[model samples]
Target: MTAADRSARLRGLIAPGLAALVCLAILVGLGVWQLARKGEKEALIARIIERSHAEPPAAPPPFADWDPKADEFRRVRAGGILLHDRETLVHGLAPGEPGRALQGYYVLTPLRREDGTTILINRGFVPTELKDPQSRAAGQVGGETSVTGMLRGSEVRTMFVPESDPARDAWFTREIPAIAAARGLTNVAPYLIEADATPNPGGWPRGGQLRVDLPNNHLQYAFTWFGIAACLVGVFSVFAWRRLHDPMEPGAA
Candidate 1:
């Protein structure tokens, strides 16, 4: 094989080889980004877990004193009568561990605290078959009952979705303010109550099934990206080798 032929083949490989290298670098960069995101997610999960297990804090002043950033997820203890007639059923939630095709609803009612503030309470998830609001008869707690739970800010409405129809007893999202207005509630707390796992009467709206899990698969995603980068490098290497050696055959020369 002539040296000139070999030189020509080497020159032809340079452009494609460089392009492949650039692609490999891009894939590697993406993989690194995903890894960093995974680390961030893990840290966030740790914080949430810590918050969930911490003891409940004292109740803040009122909705007027609520500061979402500083007070979100803050635990508090309060007591009031559950307004059973005004209970709002949040639709689209499924029942049981497997969350199969069975439909269900989240029982939400206003708790009129002693301080004259109304706080929405998510009693618990109930099956759709028990849609009769009266199925769970209103049992008075008699006097003020002490309730402990997490403080969550108001639920926001998503864009492009129709507003919930309370008259029809249908709800898709948890827009607290809207729900409060529909129930003719005044001075409603800025947050809702996620009841603690406590024993309640009749076992209705069984409290304590709040699953606060955050998905953090950033590490796996990062590895996948890195694997793609490695594949890119291998493909480029093969292409480069073929270009450099194919023309070196004696017959071809």
Candidate 2:
């Protein structure tokens, strides 16, 4: 081809070529990010499993010594009087099996320690019908009680999730501060006790609320991003090759 013809062909590719380059960079970057996420997710899952299975301390650590990040999911034993009068229900969805989800609400009740400190215990799941405290009266044991469970931080609600309505006693997430304030509790622990699966008095509020099921599909996500990047490269390569072989009008895209 003549020099002018070659230059025209190269110029014809400028718009589409720059577009493909930008897309390719984004896709490859996403792939790398997902791979890094996979490693971080794996480490987090390991730490959570270890904490969940470890032997608990005699009693929960002092409130002043609490650390949200380092102390989450730590198993501990806490003794206090069950304040059944002040209970909050956080909506929950437990998987009964593959493709089956059992909808319920987690019963959270404040436990009053001898030292006048309070901590909320996620006493666990109860079907919608038994949401009312009177419906599950037997499980609402009064007086002092000891509970073994893992410590957890407050659950955050996303922008898409609805805000907790204290007036109606409706909560979408396990928000500690909101619940404590709504229930008029004082000196409450910063963290919550996710009770272990020890059967309750009437078996209404089941314990063992360990919901640490982190999905590790980052590898698959990385592959998908990389695959799209590869396909883009292949398509651009073929288009550029064809464009280079064929004649193009001057300044055409």
Candidate 3:
């Protein structure tokens, strides 16, 4: 091809080449971001496992010092009277002793601590039939008793999850502040406690059903993005080679 013709052909490829480069860069960046997230998730899983196995602390850190990122999943013991009158049920499901899936509601009661501050304690899951406190009144421990459980933060709701309805007493997730407000409570701790596997008297609200099996799919996502980027490079290389050699094929002017 003539010098001018070759220059024109090269110029035609500029926009497409630049676009491919930008797309590749974005894909690679996403892959790198996922890798970073994988690291953060790994560290989080390690912390959760360690805290789950550790002995319960004498008491949780003061409300003023509560940090979701640092204090979540901590095993703690707090002395208080479970205010069953103000208890609320949150919708949930748990594995039954027979290994069957059991639909239930988590019994969350406000525990009035000795300091007069109130904290929400997740007494644990009760079957759908035992949702009413009256149905399992015997399990409702009154007066003063120490609660031992893991310190947990408010749950993050997804866009698809419906909002909590206090009037209907329907709670899809454990939203601490919202629950406290709905129940007309103040000085409530920012976090909630998942009561340990301690058996209750009535064997109703089965405690210790908390599971920490967080799905770690960041690595898989990272690989997917990286694989796409690699395929893009290979495809682009083939396209570029074909474009460069098109005129050299059998077609002569």
The lDDT leader among the candidates is 2
TM-score versus the correct structure, for each prediction: 0.73, 0.90, 0.91
Clashes of 3: 0
Global lDDT scores for all candidate models = 0.74, 0.88, 0.86
> Which residue ranges in model 2 land beyond 4 Å of their true spot?
58-62, 249-253
Q: What is residue 70's positional error in candidate 2, in angstroms?
A: 2.0
| Model 3 TM | 0.91
Which candidate, 1 or 2, would have the higher lDDT against the true structure?
2
Error of 2 at 138 (Å): 1.5
* Ten contiguous residues minimizing lDDT sum, candidate 3: 244-253
Which regions of candidate 1 are displaced past 4 Å? Answer: 1-30, 62-71, 92-102, 138-143, 154-167, 212-214, 241-245, 248-253
Q: Quote the positional error of residue 145 for candidate 2 in Å.
A: 1.4
Cα distance off (Å), candidate 2, residue 248 = 4.0
Candidate 1 contains a number of clashing pairs equal to 0
lDDT of 2: 0.88
Residue 249 of model 3 has an lDDT of 33
lDDT of 1 by residue, 65-103 (tens): 777666666667778877777888887454466746556
